[model samples]
Each structure stands twice: as C-alpha cells, then as structure tokens.
Target chain A: MKTDVSSRVVDKGQKQSHFTANLGSRYTIDRIFKYAAWGATGVSILILVWLLVTIVADGIGTLNWNFITSFPSRRAENAGIIAALVGTVWVMCLVALFTVPLGVGAGIFLEEFAEDNWFTRLVEINIGNLAGVPSIIYGLLGLAVFARIMQPITGGRSVLSGSLTLSLLILPVVIVSTREALRAIPNSLRLAGYALGATRWQVIWSHVLPAAVPGILTGVILALSRAIGETAPLIAVGAAVFISFLPEGLQSQFTAMPIQIYNWVGRPQEEFHYIAASGIIVLMAMLLVMNGVAVYLRNHFQKDF
Target chain B: MTDNVTGDIAPGSWSPKRDRAKAIQTIVKIIFGSFAAISILTTIGILATLIFETIEFFKEVPISQFLTDTRWTPLFASKQFGIFVLVSATMMISVISIMVALPLGLLSAICLSEYATPRIRRILKPMLEILAGVPTVVYGYFALLTVTPFLQIFLPDLQGFNALSAGLVLGIMITPMVASLSEDALYAVPRSLKDGAYALGATKRETVTSVVLPAALSGIVSSLILATSRAVGETMIVTLAAGANPTLGFNPFVPVMTMTAFIVQITKGDAPYGTIEYKTLYAVGMTLFIMTFALNIFSFWFVRRFREKYD
Candidate 1:
C-alpha cells in the first residue's frame, strides 16, 4: 500500500511538470505570434513611409514653379506639367458632372423605388461585378464605344470620352456609397415625412437627399481622387503623351498627370525619372487634398440618429 | 345620387396641382430608372465591344495558334501570336505578389482584428486607407526608380526592369486592400466563438487561429482571391517596372510583360483602328476579362457557400 501511494504521488508530479512545459511552449508561441503581427503592421507602415520619403527626396529638386507651368518637352529639364494638370481638371469636373446625377439617381431608385425583384437583384449583382472589372477593361470599352462608335459625339479619345469612361468606372463606387448613405438615414425620418403627407419623391428630395448629401459628397470626392490617379484607362484611350498645348475644351485631345508621369518614367534618362517623381508629388498632393476633404466630410457630418 | 355627390367632391380634392405632381413623379421615376439602366448598358456595351472585336480577331488568327504558339511577337515582323508568353509572365508576377501579399495582409488583418487596441486600430485603419489611396502610377514610379535599384544591391543579375520590384510594389499596394477586407471578415466572427475557445484554456493566439480564423475562413479566402485578381489586372506597375519582354519563362529576376502591359504597349503605340494588332488587344483583353470575371464569381460563390451565420 505504501509503495502504491508513493508511485501515484510521483506520477502526479511528473504530469504537472509536463503540463507546465506544454504551457510554457504555448505561451512562448503566443508571445512570438503577438510580435509577428506587430511586425507585419510595422512593415506595411514602413513601406508607405519609405515610398513617400524616396519620392520626395528624388523629386523635390525638380519640383518648381516652372515644372508646373511649362509644357511637356523632349528635353527632360524643360518638360512641364501644365497641359496634363489642366487636362486632369477638365476630366475630373466632367466626371463629377456625369457621375453624380447618374450614380446618385441610380442609388435613389434602387433604395427608394425598386422592389425586391430579379431586375433589382440583377442590377445589384451587375454593379458588384462591374466594380471588380479591371479599369483597363473599362478603357477598352471606352476605346471601342466612346472613342469609336460614338466618335462623332465624343470626338474620338478626347477629354469628354476619357471623362465618360471614368464616369462609368466609378459609377459603381458612387452608387454603392450613395446607397449606404441613404440606407443610414433613419426609417423614422422617411416615415415622418410620409406622415406629413409628403409624396415619396417629395420626402426623398426634401428630407432624405438633404440628409445624404455629405455622405454622397464624401463618396464623390474619393471617387474623383481615384479617377485622378488613374493612368491605364487614359493610356488605353490613347491620351497623347507629348502634347505641348493644353486642352481647349471637353472634345479636345488631352493628356492627364498620370500619363505624363508614365511617359516620363518610361524614358531611359535618369532626369526624366526625377521629373516623373515631381509629377507624382503633384498628383499625391492633389490626392491628399481630396482625400482630406473626404475624410473631413465623413467625420464632420456623420450623424447618429 | 351618391356617384354624382362623390364626383362633385373629388375634383376639388384631386386638384390640378395633384395631377401635375403625379405627372412629375412618374417622369422623375422614369428618368431615375433610365439612369439605373445605364449601368446595365455599360456592361452590355463592354461585352458587345469585346465580343465583336474578339470575334474579328479570331477570324484572322486561328484559336489553335493563339493557344499553342510559343512566341508572342504580335508587333514584330515575324508576328507570332502566342498568349502563353504573356500569361506566363503575368502569372509569374502575380504569384510573386501573392506570395508577399497573403502573409502580410492576413497577419495585419489578424493583428488589427484580434489584438490591436481601439486607439491603435483607429490610427492603423486610416494609415492603411492612405496606403490604398496612393496612386498605382506612383507605385509604378517607386518600383522603377527606387525599388528596382534597391533590389539590385542584393541581386546583381536583377534587371533594371524586372518582375521582382514590380511584384513587390504591387504586393504592398494590394496588401492594404486585403488587410481591410480580411479585417472586416475577422471582425464579423462572433464574440462567442472566441469566448468558447478561451474557456477551453486556449491562449489568445490559439483562440484566434483555431476559432476566429476558422470561422472567418471564407471571408479571408475570398479577400485573398480578390487581391489576386487585382494583381492579375494591375497594369501600371508592371508596365513601368516590369519591362516589355514577352518571354515564356517565369523568372522574377528578369523582365516580363503582362496582358495589361501588352495592351498599354499596343495602345501607346499607333495601332490604328481596324487592324490585326488592334484586334489582338481585344483578344488579349477578352482573356484577361474572363480570368478576373471567373475569379470574382468564384469568390462571390465561396462567400455565399461558406459564410458562417451566427445569427
């Protein structure tokens, strides 16, 4: 009996140590994983910082008033971004003009009027897929349709065509955001508007639309920011790379900031790379401003009720 | 007598203004409906354009040659139209990108969702958003000028325009997207699941790995797939950084050309309308479209099939 009791005590002690050893390993793994996760996050932030620093360091010397004012030239030192910058402004304005009404209107129709049917479902699915469709595909569509089939109207790969293509590209984004913003407006608000004997259109126009403006604006700004940075679609639509003159109107052939940057970057000359970086700085500044506005609008106008 | 009395009262109640308002409402609805229809029209237009052009292309170049040709010198004098050359290069870069992106993205998502404090989460989220919002063209520039040179220090043989730098930059570019989407998925995993794991003496790491991640598996998978699709479709970084060498080899150290890059190459050059070279763009585009479209559909289907409904 004595021997058995001692053996059982020894076994219990061994089991405890084994359990603790297992836990020690587990705890070590937990600590390692925690640090690994932190490292991953750190690495991502580090890359962003590195990319910015590199661009600024490389481009700051080239970024001057002349760089912004002068037209693109064969000489790397002489090339300026005047033509591309103006073209970007024109395209952005037209994109905003075309997309807002169409995107917001579609969002309103889907959220307010469309019933739960196959057609609504199809539209919803189509938008989702369209959002995933590569921007280059949109470029091809623009190339084929707006630039070719509708050449008479779009003037063939003009600023109007580019803007129209971008409008289509970002329409899904705008519609989704508009729907989200509209969805956030309390049902009670709509109900109260109806209780006041307002028609559906009246309530949406006077109450819901007003409430959703900030959200829609935020979405629009972000979408425009995206549109501005876009290069491939414009390239596919055949935006000229060496235009010394600025676009006169919507129908005129144009080059935007990205195309100019792309053109500069493609050159074998190291000087062109510097100018490319400078152009990127300008583009980044524009994006930063627009994104700042979007973030501000979102935070400032976010409503609880 | 009742009908006469009702008719007399109805005119005043249903005023001309009411008729006008009703008419306006109908007109507005129709207009809005047409606006909605435009999105559909865009999709139809894309399909119609691609199909027509692609058909025209296939009429000239046999499908068998397109599939089997070992070389893709569509612009050259020899005119060999082998798509595998472009596909291989595209796949090589995308594979490299996914290699970099998946772990970084998944880990970031895990940390943000499972470990980060609210303060940290708030700061990190916007930072990631900023990363995402930075232009692809900028990334392309960074890849060509900064990353490739930096990479050349370690890899002496790495070309100035190679897949490695492009893939690396592309990976970093898409990481934020993957992280954001995966974080959403991880956040969607219910509290009860983690609690149960903890109650069973699982550590935080164990709970996340065995419980939360498993539950959020579908979403993470979908996010990864979507990011891969984005990588495949990515143009500027590859066009600028990955040189326009359409070789049928998977070498990250060397230059490569992706489908999107090829399209850019063709369009940037003067392939006037109604030419075989121009038609090749549509053919290649059709292939790219199908690839991304299939991946997207698969991702959507996966989410629908495997999403864990806690409610």
Candidate 2:
C-alpha cells in the first residue's frame, strides 16, 4: 500500500510539470503571433507613408499656378498638365452624366420593380463578373466598340470614348451601391405610401428617392473617384500623351491626368519624373476631396432605424 | 364611392389623368428595364469583340503553334507566335505577388478581426482603404523609380525593369483587398464557437488557428482567388516596371512582359486596325479574359459550396 501511494504521487508530479510546460509554450507562441501580426500591420502603414512622402517631397517644388495652367511642351521644364487636367474634368463630367441615371435606374428596377427571377439573377451574376474583369479588358472593349465600330458617333478615341469606357467600368459599382442604399430604407415607408393610395412610381419619387439620396450620392462620388484614377482603360482607349491643346468638346481627342502621368513616368528623364509626381499630387488631391465629401455625406446624413 | 363623393370620375369610366399616369409608369418601367439591360449588353459586347477578333487571329496563326511555340516575336521579321513565353512571365510575377501578399494580408486580417478594438479598427480600416485607393499609375511610378532602385542595393544584379519590383509593388497594392475581405470572413466566424474554445482552456491563437480559421476557410480562399485575379489582370504596374521583354522562364531578376503589358504595348504603338499584329492583341486578351473569368467563377462557386452556416 505504501509503494502504490508513492508511485501515484510520482505520476501526479510528472503531470503537473507537463501541464506547466505546455502552458508556458502556448503563451509564448501566442505572444510571438501577436507581435508578428502587429509587424505586418506596421509594414503596410509604413509603405503607404513612404509612398506619399516620396511623391509629395519630390513634387512640391515644381507645383505652381503655371504648372496647372500651361500646356504641354517639348522642354520638360516648360511642360504642364493643363491639357490632361482639363481632359480629366471633361471625361469625369460626362462619366457622371451617363453613369448616374443608368446605374440608379437599373438599381431601382432591380431592387424595387423587378421580381425574383432567372433574368435578374443572371444580371446580378453578370455584374459581379464584370466588376472583377480587368480595366484593360474594358479598354479593349472600348477600342473595338466605341472607338472603332461607333467611330462616327464617338469621334474615335475622343473624350466621349474615354468617358463611355469609364462609365461602363464604374457602372457596376454604382448599381451595387444604389441597390444597397435602396434596400436599407424600411419597407414600412413603401407600404404607408401604398396605403395612402399612392402609385408605385409616386411612392418611389416622393418618398423613397429622397431618403436614399445621401447614400446614393456617396456611392456615386466614390465611384467617380475610382473612375478618375483609371489609367489603363484611358490608355487602351487611345488617350494622347502629348496633346498641346485642351479638349474642346466630347468629340475632341484628349489626355487625362493618369495618362499624362504615365507618359511622364515612362520617359527616361529625371525632370519628367518630378513633373509626374506633381501631376499625381493634383490627382490625389482631387480624390481626397471627393472621398472627404463622401465621408461627410455618410456620417452627416445617415439615418438610424 | 370615393369617386362619386368627389364627383370627378365615374365608377366605370376611365379618367384621362389616371390613364396618362398608368402609361407613364409603364414607360418608366421600360426605361429602367432597358437601363438594367445595358450591363448585359456590355458582357455581350466584350464576348463578341473578343470572339470575332480571336477567330481572325487563329486563322493566321495555327492554334498548335500559338500554344506550343516558345517564342512570341510577332512584331519581328522571324514571326513566332508561342503564347507560353508571355504566359510564363505573367504566372511568375503573379506567383511572386501572391507569395508576398497572402501571408501579410492574412496576418493583418487576423489582427484586425481578433485583437483590435472597435475604435482602432475604425481608424486602421480606413487607413488600409486609403492604400487601396491610391492609383495604379502612381504605384507604377513608385515601382520603377523608387522600389527597383532600392531593391538593387540589396541585389546588385537586379535589372532596371525587373519583375521582382513590379510584383512586390503589386503585392502591396492588393494587400488591402485581401485583408478587408478576409477580415470580413474572420469576423463572421460565430462568436459562440470562439467562446467554446476559450471555455475549453484554449489560447487565443489556438482557437483562431483550429476553429475560427477552419470555419472561415472558404471565404479566405475566395478572397485569395479574387486577389490572384486582380494580379493577373494588372496592367499599368507591369507595363511600366516589368520591361517589355517576353521571356520563357521564371526569373524575378530579369525583365519580363506580362500579357496585360503586351496589350498595353500594342495599344500604345501603331498596331493599325485589322492587321495580324493588331489581331494578336485580341488573342492575348482573350487568353487573359478566360483566365480571370475562370478564377472569378471558381471563387463564387467555392463560397456557395463550402461556406459554414452558423444559424
């Protein structure tokens, strides 16, 4: 009986040591993991900070009123982004004009009017697929359809073609966001309108649209910001790199800020790289303003249930 | 009864204003319906454009030669149309990017979902999104002018336009996307499961690795696939930094041209419409489109098939 008791005591001691060892190692592993994750997060933030600081430091000296106003030149020092800037504005305006109506209408139809069916499902799937398609592929589509086939109407790789391509590119984003915004409104509002003998269209126009406007506007602004930064599609649509004059109309050939920046970056000169950095600053500033407005709209006007 | 009380309309008679409003509603529905159909039209346009041009391209270059040949020198006098050269380069860069992005993105996602407080998440999420919102052209500039130069200091043999720099920057560009999607997935893991793990005397890391990660596997895989698709379709960074040389091997140090980069090169140059050279762009694009489309479809399918249901 004495020998059996001693053996049991020895077994208990071994179990205790093993448990403590496992606990210590587990804690150590957890600590190591925590530090590793923090390190990853730090690396991402560092990269962003480094990128912005580099661009800003390199370009701040060259940024001036003339840099924004003058035309492209053969001399790197004299060259400016006036043509590209104006072209971007022109394209963005047209893109907005085309995208908002079509995208919102589609969203309203799918969310409000259309019944659950295979066709609606197909469209949803198609839009999802299109969103994942590369921007360069859209550029190819624009080249074939808007630029080549519809040349008589689009004037062949003009601002109109670029705008149309970007409109298509961002159309999915707008439609998806609009649907989400519309979906967020309580169904009780629609039912109340109907109970008051309101037509569907009347209910949508008088009650639903006003409530969803802030949300839809925010989405549109974000989508436009994305469209503004697109370079591959613009390049594929044949945006000029060295247009000296500003775009006169939708039909006029043009260059955009990104395409211009791309042109400058591609050149084998140090001065052009600095100028490209300046152009990027302007583009990023525009995006920042747009995104700021979007945030404000979301936070300031968002309503709770 | 209401009509009789108002004395404005007969019970059985059609009111002109009501008829007009009804007609307007029908017309409005048609307009909206047609607007929705535009997306369908876009898909059709892409398919039709690619198919027509691709068919034309195949007529000039045999399918076997296009697939089997090792050289892609259609622009030169000795015309060889092997697509493997470009595809190999594209795959090499994509693999390099995936290597950099997957681990970094997943770990950051874990930290955000499991460790960060709500306020910290709010701040960090937007900061990461800002990284995503930076334009691709800017990234290309950074890659060519800054990243390559910096990388050369460590590896002296790195070319001015090497795949390593382009892939590395592309990885950075896509990290936010992977993190955001994966965080959503990890956050969706049922709290009850995590609580059970804690009750069972499991550490946070053990619970996450054994239970949470397993449940969120489908979503994580889909996000990875989507990121891969993005890398495959990336154009500007590859074009600007990865040089125009279409090589057949997997060397990150040398200059390589991706499929998208080739399209950009052709588009930027004077490959006039209807020429064999111009047709080759569509051919390469068709290949690229098929690859991305397959990946996207697979991602969707995987999510639908394997997602863990908590309810």
TM-score on alpha carbons, each prediction: 0.95, 0.96
Q: What is candidate 2's TM-score against the reference? A: 0.96
Residue by residue across B1-311, what tens digits does model 1's lDDT show? 54565577884655334456667778898899889989899999989989999999999999999999999999888899999999999888888898988989999999898888899999998999899999899999989889988989998999988999999999999999899999999999889888888888787888988889899999999999999999999999999999999989888888889999999999998788999999999999999999999999999999999999897
Q: Model 1, stretches more than 4 Å misplaced?
A: A1-21, B1-16
TM-score of chain A of each: 0.94, 0.94
| Candidate 1 CA-lDDT value | 0.91
Over B6-85, each residue of candidate 2 has an lDDT whose tens digit, in order, gives: 46644656433555666787888899989999999999999999999999999999999999999999889999999999
Which runs of model 2 end up more than 4 angstroms from their true locations? A1-21, B1-17
Estimate, for each residue in A169-238, the C-alpha lDDT of model 1 and write its tens digit: 9999999999999999999999998897677888899999999999999999999999999999999988
| TM-score of the A chain in model 2 | 0.94
lDDT (Cα atoms) of all candidates against the true structure: 0.91, 0.92
- DockQ, prediction 2: 0.74
lDDT of 2 at A2: 17
